[model samples]
Target: MKFKSAFYLLFFFSAFLSFDGVAQNKHTFEIKQGNFLYDGKAIQIHSGEMHYSRIPHQYWRHRMQMLKAMGLNSVATYVFWNHHEILPEQWDFEGDKNLAEYIKIAGEEGLLVVLRPGPYACAEWEFGGYPWWLQNISGMELRRDNPEFLKRTEIYINRLFKEIGHLQITNGGPVIMVQVENEFGSYVSQRKDIPLNEHRSYNAKIKDQLVRAGFNVPLFTSDGTWLFEGGAIDGVLPTANGEGNILNLKKAVDQYHGNKGPYMVAEFYPGWLAHWAEPHPAIDASNIARQTEEYLKNDISFNLYMAHGGTNWGFTSGANYDKKHDIQPDLTSYDYDAPISEAGWATPKFDSLRAVIKKYAQYDIPDIPAPFSTIEIPSIKLTRVGDVLSILEKQKSVQSTTPLTFEQLNQGYGYVLYSRKFNQPISGTLDVSGLRDYAVVYINGEKVGELNRYYNNYTMEIDVPFNSTLEILVENMGRINYGPEIVNNKKGIISPVKINNIEIEGNWEMYTLPMQEAPDLDNIKKNDVFNVPAKTKQLQGKPIIYEGVFDLSEVGDTFLDMENWGKGIVFINGINIGRYWHVGPQQTLFIPGVWLNKGSNKIVIFEQINSELKSEVKTVKTPVLNKLK
Candidate 1:
């Protein structure tokens, strides 16, 4: 009798998971006569969007298990073009970005895939996920049908499809649907540079490229209901994505995917993205349940915009701007107040949403996977190992009549320092109206004042000494990912540094400080000059590299409390985890267990502003994401 019961349970599970099996026989899924029929059987796409590049590879299974446990049947992800192709003609697909491996692994977990391979995925990702070198292209207008941009976009899309095209459902893999270009209506509708036909042509071209590259899965395009008219293309399933107002969404869907029947909310935002120096974006867990229930009650197919809002990791975080042109640099912690937090632990939001899904999907949900471990490590003693001045001694310098931007210097990400010597003594407001972002003004390597793009604090009047060497260190915090301004979002002192509205005339020395990799700890530990200012407040205004070493009997994930610290980037064991600032909202840096060691570990931080307190770091069990501006 027990054996018979077990067989029945297995059969029931298999029957309920038919959507996954839909790929097994015909290898084709279709939406006809108002139903998404798989093997002629209707199936609901209970899905969530998670990026493999955002989450650590080691925890991929853990997160997927969490998603499945939520009664979800499918997963969606975006392929970031800039991440793989860092330089011109060079590419990498190994490690976390292995598209084929990520899809195969999701299939192994019994979940179907919905691939959103965007040559332009604007998920608060840097440059809307376009490589920096693309800006150097002559007459290149991105996200349009310009020949140069199109040629490059096609090259990247084709190369990426070659990696995962065979894995589509039609080809006997878990991938079922592929998205054309990301929401372009709200963007292109206001563009004065590109023509309307070019926008329409580019939209069609993206789909054509996908088909030519062997993606036989059903194709779809997504946008907010308001943008459907401009963003959607003919013959493609148009999907709506936004937080609430389901009534209007349904009406819009009816007009577009109306006759087609099955519709999808490709990006359902449970929580929103927050920027540094701003209030944390927190949504009530109850609201998450209510909205999710609304989708289910209407029998609408939806995917959580972010099931697990993992870390931005490294220098990949992007920035955004408002109508006022206020630049808001996104906090490094993508924690997004998501159901699964940055530390990969379940929150109340997860529990609330799970109950809704269980009732709506009518599936027997499994036990939640054991929560990932977290530990509070002992205090780490950090020593100032290097100063910005010493590090510049051995670097190459660019001399230009005007201060060149990062793109002009063939540089991307990280910070750049512009130095110039003024033989004439002048006193006036140093007009840095052309400053792309933030800069620390220095008189002979000493910090004077800072000009910021966020608050438009771009002018400073200071005394000028004769033959005084001036140094300005500018950080490319992030480029504008979404806006009419993206085409010109180059970083650093983009134009010639001017004094009193007149461009300062002088030969400039430029240093490229793209901190892609961590510096050698041995060299830092050997240098003692960096200790001078740390011990005394005299020269604390310059950027300093603080190194720390600690031994651990065992290693587990922990959050580094950076509440007392200032703006800077953190490196653990010679790997950049991302940036941190003493702004409201995210003040903790997640140190993953996968990046830690049991024996010994090295940490280096390049701090732009010195913490008022001693150079100290503490590991905490939880993250503080509720701070208001």
Candidate 2:
């Protein structure tokens, strides 16, 4: 009787695991008549979107567990091409970029995976995730049937598949579906220059690339409801993005998916994305809960666009194009007003939505884990370490008759210093042609004026005596992530420098300041003499590097309050956390505890616009994401 009881218990547990979609055995995941089937059983994919590139690897398991606790059975992620391959043929999959490890963690947490590996993932990421080097390729047309683009894309997909392709459900991995070419229908609509059929053909080519690269599971395309006609592939499944109406979803899927029925909302927004100057976007928790209930009741599978909106970290943020703000660069903190805050804490929306999910979840939901605790640090005073010129002295400069773009210089992100020595005193309206984003003009190390592309301000007044040096520091805020303008998006001064409408011709010195990592300031201070100012004062638009160090007995996640500082990038130890701007909205940069050391930790700030009278930064347990300047 005891043996029978043990056997019965074992049978019951195995059945429960299989029914709950937790069993890791090789299973068939298919789309039949628009619904998903796992091992011949109908299943609803309660999934959420989370970028492994955005979240710290140390906390990936925690975030996965958070999603599981919210009753999600699946997790979706976009494999950013630019992120994996920072440079052409130079790939990085170790450390935080470990994509396979992230997916395995999701499976360990009993969640299926949906892979959206876009050579162009417009998640407000840099260049829509296209490597900057692609622009340097001759005749490289992106998202089209261009041979140059396809050749590189095929290479990228094959390399990516080798990393996570075997993890598909057919191979005993969690990945059930793979997406091809993100939102191509919307892109085609925006770019009227390209024919509709060409866009569709290009989409088909990408889908073929995925299959050839060894993706054996179902493939799908996601676009807004109105975009399905152009976005959907003939044989592949179609998913809706941003469609709240159940009727609209069904109609679109039926219209596009050969009258089939496995409908899924690929990107249901719990909270909207936040821009730099825009008000924090928030959808009421009740509204999300209501929509969720409707989805569950109607048997519509859905995935939260951002279950946890993580930080953009470093120069990874992208900008948007519109009539309102010409080049609206996204804030470094991609808080997105999401269910999980930038620091990985669950919000009211998470709680309320989780409650709704509990009712429909096939299995018991795990208890939500406690959010990570934050540590506050005492104020640390920063010293003026060195100027940009001092740092440039250590690097090589390219001499060109015309100013080159960042790509021309083989530089991806950060600032480029364009300088020319004037033989005679020159005083006139200084104009820069094709200035990609922002520039700070200086004459003999003194700032003269500023030019911003967002406001379409390209010309500025300058009066410098003869034999003085004129330098224009151009900053690539971010590449345009969406729209047709991306084809023309190139950083730095792409044209000739002009004075009073006359093009100034001569030898120009270009300095590359790609701040991919923090500069060795300690060595610079030791080797070079930095004259300390007698008193603290405003930077007067002069870009300066400030360095500070603080010792910690213990460390945890914390927010570095940058209210007192100005527009610049912050680096902890040698790793760049992200950029900070005084222009309101995001006043703090989230620093993960794993990135922080228990001993002495160094902080470096490359202040361009604003710096406090007292150069200092404070740490807070809570974030100041909503605070706008």
Give the runs in model 2 whose Cα sits over 4 Å from its true position.
1-24, 525-541, 610-613
The digit string of per-residue lDDT tens for model 2 on 107-207 reads 76767889999878999898899998999999898789999999999999999998987788777777899998998888988888888888888999999
lDDT of 1 by residue, 505-580 (tens): 6688889888888866455434534553355354477777777888888888898988878788999997789998
Pairs of residues clashing in candidate 1: none
Cα distance off (Å), candidate 1, residue 331: 0.6
Residue 567 alpha-carbon offset, candidate 2, angstroms = 0.8
Best by TM-score: 2
TM-score of each: 0.94, 0.94
lDDT for residue 51 in candidate 1, whole number 0-100: 91
Q: Rate the local accuracy (lDDT) of all candidates.
A: 0.79, 0.83
The total number of steric clashes, by the backbone 3 Å criterion, in model 1 comes to 0
The per-residue C-alpha lDDT of model 2 at residue 244 equals 93
